[model samples]
Target: MKNALLIATACLLGLLSTTGASLPYPILPPLFVNGAPDSLTHFLGLPPKLLFALALMVNPIGLLLGTAVLGSLSDRYGRRPLLLVTAVGAAIGHVLTAWALASRSYPLFLVARFGTGLLEGHSAIVRAMLADRLQGPLRNHALSWLNGALHLGWLVGPLLAGFTIAWGLTIPFYIAAGALLLGAALVGFALERKPRAAGPSWWSVARERHAFNLLRHDGLRALFGVQLAYTCGVTAFYEFYPLWLVEVGHYDTRAIALVNVGMCGLMTCSALFAGRASRTEPMRRAAWLAACVALAIGSLGVGHLWVGLVGIMAFGLPHAFYNAVVQAWAADRFGGGHGQGAVMGLLSTTFCLANILMAAAGAVLTLVDTRLVLLTGAILTAWAANRMRAWGSGAMAGLPPAA
Candidate 1:
């Protein structure tokens, strides 16, 4: 029953995570960019994209805060309730987003995005539920599917939006809302399980020595540290790649989407192998290979369009692999209720921190030169790979290395 619930929840999560939060970038930008009244400004009579950017920043802010609080809450209240709540919240948020779009209300739309962000369903309840349900190879397998779901969600979002735009933007929100509500229903009815235990208190979850103990548990730190560095590079590329293609490589939105398709394809293909690798001696080898692949892939951008596309493909495969490996590894280390919640929250926090740093560097690089940023990312990735290799070696020193 527990394993069944976990698998079911994973499917629901895959659907819920596919909502159009990230999709708006690819679709809505064209709406606003081509002299259409910026929806926010036209609807709300707001000043400009600057203030909107300030207010809309709440999306990611809410995401980070929501995931942190919800992760803890899931531990305390149990995964089922929190899952239902966030799913409902996401559903409501999307409905509101649709209404806001229809009514042409920028302020209201911002509120909807903030609400959507607050659900934080991906990292909190979904990951917690997975940790609660699965074990060993099965657990790793489940995470690989989840990793693929993440990319699948991202891939479909924009493609779906692009197609749905012919009908109107508001329709996508309605579709997203339906997905969320259905996900809620899946957890409510399909899981049919009791709460595991009382989760850890917020204050208690914070004390690192008691819970995390990375010094004693060096493997966990190595996993999370890889996440930190990997996210840094990935975020940098996501921020600048489109612009780099446009300015340096001379590609359009259609071309960009095609490139994204390649990325998604590589990631999906690599996730399964990564899951299998996590079970044995090849774990460390896989990580090193993935990181090196990312470095090499990222470096390919130093040349031309085809070269860069190959690089992106290479980078995406290793990245997708690492994501599953790290998450599975973290869950192995801290699979208990509150501990799982705390680990999920910490992972998201690390991702956000890395993204922030990367974004700052990206902004500066744009002023300096875009190619410089890509080159820097390649160098940083290589350096990070070396660090990870060292960490993995140290972790393996005590145990008979797996084969």
Candidate 2:
């Protein structure tokens, strides 16, 4: 019963948090490019495209720091308290974002997004919680549940934002804020209060025990490199496609949301399926999946919008399979010794770093051509696939020397 409750709460929190986080996705591109000029969108005479990149980059910057620190904090301090506080704090961040949108203040928007991203890392906390209580296959299953919930939220968030945006531009953020507060309340109710182990001072913990601490382990070094390269590809695809839609596909907010609906809906289904499916040769599977994603995305370079949309929608299944198998491999290999929180946090850190790198590079690339971003994603993922194939063959030629 306790396990059931925890999983349920985890799913709920995943849904709410992802929905809140994704609310601005369908909104931001149009707001920057096509929405009526305002102080926020037209800030300091910078091009809207550059400002949009800044908008996308800031939150993930905070997420990088927060995911690194917050996960380790839960390891020492306890999960329930930190999770609840961060949920509430993220809710506050959403309110500030809504205000920034209303007042047309780009600086305030950036600050609010950074703060929100910093506080909104409780999803990682919940993953650590799952890893803490569950072991072996059960842990993998629980992660699938969370993955499904998150992808469903991805679908729901854009739909809600797209459909209701005409009501008011800020309504989606307000709704997101409300949903987060409700998630906080649910976290307080469903999660049990666990006694924290006695540990060093909080500041000391923050200083010493970050997600990067896991890098000392030699076995994970290659894994880290592969994941980072792959995530660079993934993040590039994620951050740029909407811009692709805006500039090349000639899509507006609602159409982009609808397109995301197809992608995310399929992703939600695929993640659940991948979680339960048995598979062999995990590394090979990851390689194949990455290759498929690369091939599909490579079609974008064909310069036909409809062809690219087919590739985009086709992306979800293989990507979900890759995520499920790779994450399970990490937990199975590394979870027993290293703390799950630290392990998961490091994975998350890689993701954030990828987002940062891709977004910054994309800002420059968008200035050149949006297709350049998509092509870069294809190239990186293909390279990662080759590396993973080599890793599986024990060549380990170019990777961290297996040390």
Q: What TM-score fits each model? A: 0.80, 0.96
Runs off by more than 4 Å, candidate 1: 2-5, 28-58, 99-109, 193-223, 246-255, 278-283, 296-303, 336-338, 360-364, 367-376, 395-403
Give the alpha carbon lDDT tens digit for every residue of 1-403 in model 1.
6676677577557645654455554544334323367566455564343333333355565575676566666666677777887788888888888888788777787788777877844565677677766677887888777777777766666566656666887877788788778888887886665646665664564343122343245445555566667666666676556656666666544556667677777776777566775334345654576566557546645767777777776776777777776677667655563377767766765665555566556556655566666776666666567665655555545433222
lDDT tens digits by residue: candidate 2, 1-403: 3888888888888888778767788899888989888899999989999999889889889888888888888888988998899899989999999999988999999999999989877767888888889877778888887888877887888888999999998888889999889988988888778777887988898789888888877667778888888988888887778878888778888998999899988999998877764645778778899999898778887878899899889988898888888877777777668877778888888888888888898889888888888899889999999988878766876443221
Q: What is residue 264's positional error in candidate 2, in angstroms?
A: 0.5
What lDDT would each prediction earn against the true structure?
0.63, 0.84
Cα-lDDT of candidate 1: 0.63
Clashes of each: 2, 0
User: Any runs in candidate 2 off by more than 4 Å, and if so which?
Assistant: 277-279, 397-403
Clash pairs for candidate 2: none
